[model samples]
Target: MNSIVTLNDTNCPITTSLAIAEGVGNPHASVIKVIRQNIADFEEFGNIGFEIQNSISGAGRPTEYAILNEQQSALLLTYFRNNDTVKAFKKALIKAFFEMRDELNKRQAPAENLSRMDILQLAMQSEEERLRLEQEKLKLEHQIEEEAPRVAFAKQVEAAPDAISVAQAAKVIGTGQRRLFAFLRQIGWISRRNEPYQTKIESGYLDVKLGSWDHPDHGLKQSVTALVTGKGLSKLQKLWSERDQDHAA
Candidate 1:
């Protein structure tokens, strides 16, 4: 059997509803039901308390699972009226989680020290080299700004397309694909495996056109892309600008 609690690469202790059920000797379905009933409580605790994630089953079907952090795990355990064995497990779990967290912090201390030393070394660099590096960094920033579609199309409202792919939108918005997708999900613009930017179109936030294209692998795909209209472009420009402003603030 897999360990009920495992530390992620980042040293964060994480467990799932399944693991919690197993650890506490409860039915997984019962555990899931209780969590759903108290979903608001979990959400109030934010991402650290609980996160919904999709996983593949042994039968190759997708399943949704709740990934719980240590705090969430402890809270969940409290919901169950358990015997001595489960109570002991709960106590042990909490203790182990904190111990692991402390161990990780200790392990990271040397790396932090090395980072400080590196920063001091950089501070001692020759003035000319430092100036050159600063100039290069600024040049790179300028290039990135220039290349971003949002920056280029901000003033031209009439030239926007009807429907754009998530990849294209991310490029235009000057955000990573994954980051943009996550943001869109958070805003309820899209869900798992749903069309990108569809909610925006449905909500009249933007207009879109469905189109097909020849695929390099599959012969041809239909409705595989959405072209953003001129109006959509304007909306996107405003949204992206506001996002940038928020980040700057």
Candidate 2:
């Protein structure tokens, strides 16, 4: 292991530099021997400006050193088989060493349980299921909204005027029975009747009056011509006829 190998200052740690070169998969007697050998070699090659190179072959010029053992005639290896960050550094150095030097043939690759395709398929399926559930939830929410108003109207109808029919109330309000009830409920003018047979309007005893069309407060105005025209004009015609009869008398 007293080989004259190139390394960088970052990877110059004795244990790490050795651990990387051998790709020690598991802590073994052989791995420890390699670490000790590299550390001894580095101490021997004191600052001769060793060339620094990258782990990858395509990487640029040597940024570090690979100072070998100058004093020791033979290198003694040190073992670093652990799971800590320090151990990880050693592992990376070993991987880089084997890759850069084309020494992978000497070691076995690490074990992996999941394949690339299996992981990809699982990710895609998870996304699809999520989208489908979201769409279904949106559909159910829409249905509930559409039926809300109709359900509210039906409840109002059940609690209508007891003495006066819904039609009578509609006539007083100058609107259809259903439309009038909907408007009453919408405006919060009524509530569910507590009495067994009483309607909401009867229970609340709300006034169903259509005030004068001529009143400004009512916000209704009849044109002068319309007031004296059509069926409305019949009352005026009788009054005029009575006036004519009185003049003849």
Candidate 3:
């Protein structure tokens, strides 16, 4: 191959004017003279990189030459009149440049594959983070919704309004009467019959009073009823929040 082509430091394929002269069977000084004269035209493709080379005759000053890429090479070839030798060398040079490019692409294939894989991995991670942040945002919105009612209830109870019936307290607490009754029993605040325990009543969390009602068959009758005081409302709210957190955990 007569070392037809090689790569520059930047990995670009280049041939020197000296190599062009050798390939075309021209005098090296003659080729240099042509390049120096037509340099402005050749520079239209790109800057022509000049370098001093070892003197061919191993005497006198070193020979000066211009480094050229494929396009610059084509332009330089136009300056020389067509000949069989020059034509043959042009074809060989074209083949040599193409072979160098193929070699470079083959060598870089693994690195290119790695770069594409890295990009894909980064994209996947970004998507995962986006999804995670979206889920957290939704969870926060749900929590705010749940807290809104509880906040309103807290403000109302702290104002210490008159004692209200257990049923009314259930409505303010955002639960059904039966559900509150069951929960009160579970925490031993009341009995299975849903009446406030005497200890709780004395502690000022509840009140017990006679509720009289008329029956169809019987005369007026009286039974004990439970009511929630303001303090009890506040405590129930706290307990309800704790229960929800436990369930979530």
Candidate 4:
């Protein structure tokens, strides 16, 4: 798992409203509502940045979410009723923000000692690195454009009945079904029999459903079909993306 907080483009440590919702086990809209209701109080710490992200659902609608700095995020927590889950998330979030800020501080520590020529050299190096990043960004944007059709299809084929079969998940993830099953098995998320491990089930990443089919002459046969929940699907997507990055590297 990654840190719950992240550094934003402005080099500020921030956490999103969505992450807060997921961590606190509250609906995203409810979290957004709280932010909106208490906007003035939060702004007292700093100006909150509101942005829109496209929905991954079939509707393809955009939703508004807020980005909050450490103080604002900590303050927002006071509006929620205290609970074990909320308290735990708050602790984790605060730790993450502290760690990120410490990292930023460490990165800036060498600036005071730089000579004029060292600063000039660093500026040139930074420009070269920025150009390289721009090229990579363009490539990434092109890749996203190419995958738009598949992503659209995935949204249309939403996971149903609270979960989806491995085959269905493969379609949503834009991978071959057999390949996905193999990957899952190799990662120990599933068994050789293609069933999710008991631990994964407990983690709410997967589930099992009893299924039956008519046998040729022996009558009916029963089987357990391993299923992937929405959470599991997102996890798999992230893992697959990391795997691709590793392969590319």
Candidate 5:
């Protein structure tokens, strides 16, 4: 195998070099000495002192360690610019850099590694499974369609209106007598007219505007605060914000 394949690149040579310098502790060290030390550190310890913080939250101590604040990090970046010894150390860490990065990633979210081809294969498998499910769904839909007419006819007779006879109410509702009675009774609209053609109408109970079917409101009406929370409240807040922005704009 090519040794270069196992090497890190020199993208952040300055930082790498400073790490070496910091570890070995010599401001005026030779480039080769710094490089050797950093490489030896990698070979021996498998990583620099940087610790990755664990992402998953539980009772465990954080998995990755953090080092250096903004000032220290900035200094490290600047050190790479004027320091040849640091550059050499960075060059030596190139191979291990990628491996270290992968390890850190796995520690954060473990999963099997996948090549491009492997990902493509899995995607294709998912597509095939989805298509199979769709075909089965379509076949089931066809079966439902074949049985629908008879089922509908039976239901229609059962649910036919019992309140006022449709023929008598036709003129008042501006529809045909037969059709009007059928419609009104099915919807539970009683006649206003009294017995012996009393023509008394019962009040309509269904609120069609709320939803598709005759679903009753059922309980006491409440304030908006009771209905919204978390994401729902967030969405309402966003809508109000957008409205305000529009007015401002």
Candidate 6:
């Protein structure tokens, strides 16, 4: 018996019912009757069955032939219980299906210039890169959480004095002078000014103490610097902690 099965236009391996009958050494009419009897079973199995195709009969008259795909052929084999030939035919049909599927895959793969093995290697590499990127993203998120200033600053804020200097506040908050100033501006506590600390003091966000100091090059000069109030410190701490929590979430 010829084991070669031709693929349809869609590159699916198919064999006619007449071919299946010939393979199983059964009459065409008998095979067709059995298929019709258990059609409901085939329909339940995702409608894997046959389609009628025009064929010339032995008497030179045009008749219908049932064209079955791999799935349909396998399904039909279940009816021929204890039949060794049917079992062998099923195996051959399965092998042909796999061959046709692989051929279709090669034909449909992108980059026709590349060999199948090369394409598979590229696919594996692409998957590896995707996984690597995902892992890196998770690691970066963990690092950001671990290094957040809110964790340490929350503790510092609880132990802070009633009032602290801008420098002291910066140190407690784990930030640089420039970054602290920027944060103050962002929070609307201070605007563009020659004396931002003094402005903050006037805005009631800080307490100011006036004093005089002697400079190396200059005579006694009036110096002014503001201290962050207890309330202001609490507010800033809450803001940072909430922001950190939001990012973590």
Top candidate by TM-score: 4
- Give the alpha-carbon lDDT of every model: 0.60, 0.38, 0.73, 0.76, 0.35, 0.62
For residues 1-249, could you state the per-residue lDDT of candidate 2 as single tens digits? 323233233324232323334443544334334434465454555532322233367443222323333222123223343556546554455554455445323222232544677666656865776677679657745643433322222122222223354455456545576664454444344333211111322234432322236666767653210001122123323544565588799
Candidates 5 and 6, the one with greater TM-score: 6
Of candidates 6 and 2, the better by lDDT: 6
lDDT of 1 at 132: 71
Give candidate 1 regions above 4 Å deviation.
8-10, 48-57, 60-62, 111-249
User: Which RMSD values do the candidates have, in order?
Assistant: 15.2, 35.6, 37.0, 16.2, 27.7, 30.6
TM-score of 2: 0.20
**Candidate 3 Cα misplacement greater than 4 A, ranges:** 56-58, 112-249
lDDT of 6 by residue, 1-249 (tens): 235576554446777778878878898878887777777776664454333232435333223346677767778877886488877877777787787778667756678788888989878976776677679657755643433321222112122247777677777777666777677767756544413333344344555445589989998976544457777777777776776688899
Superposed Cα deviation of residue 26, candidate 4 (Å): 0.5
Ranked by TM-score from best down, the candidates are 4, 3, 1, 6, 5, 2
- Rank the candidate models, highest lDDT first: 4, 3, 6, 1, 2, 5
> 47 in model 5: Cα distance from truth in Å?
52
> What lDDT score goes with residue 126 in model 2?
54
TM-score of each: 0.41, 0.20, 0.43, 0.46, 0.21, 0.39
Query: Residues 1-249, candidate 5, lDDT per residue (tens digit)?
Result: 212222122212123333444533455234323334344433442334332222356444322222332223333334455466645544544434555456445434423677677777766875776677678657755643443321222111121133233243334334565553343344333222211110111122111111123336655432110011233223333554565588799
Instruction: Give the per-residue lDDT digits (tens) of candidate 1, residues 1-249.
Output: 126676643446777898777778888768877887787787676563332222335343223357787778878888999898688788778777777777666645554566776756645653555577679657755643333321222112232345566667778877777876676666555545444343355445433334468889997765423244445556666877887799999
Error of 1 at 143 (Å): 36
Which candidate, 1 or 5, has the higher TM-score?
1
Q: Comparing 4 and 5 by TM-score, which wins?
A: 4
Per-residue lDDT value at 29 in model 2: 36
In terms of lDDT, the poorest run of 10 residues in model 3 is 149-158
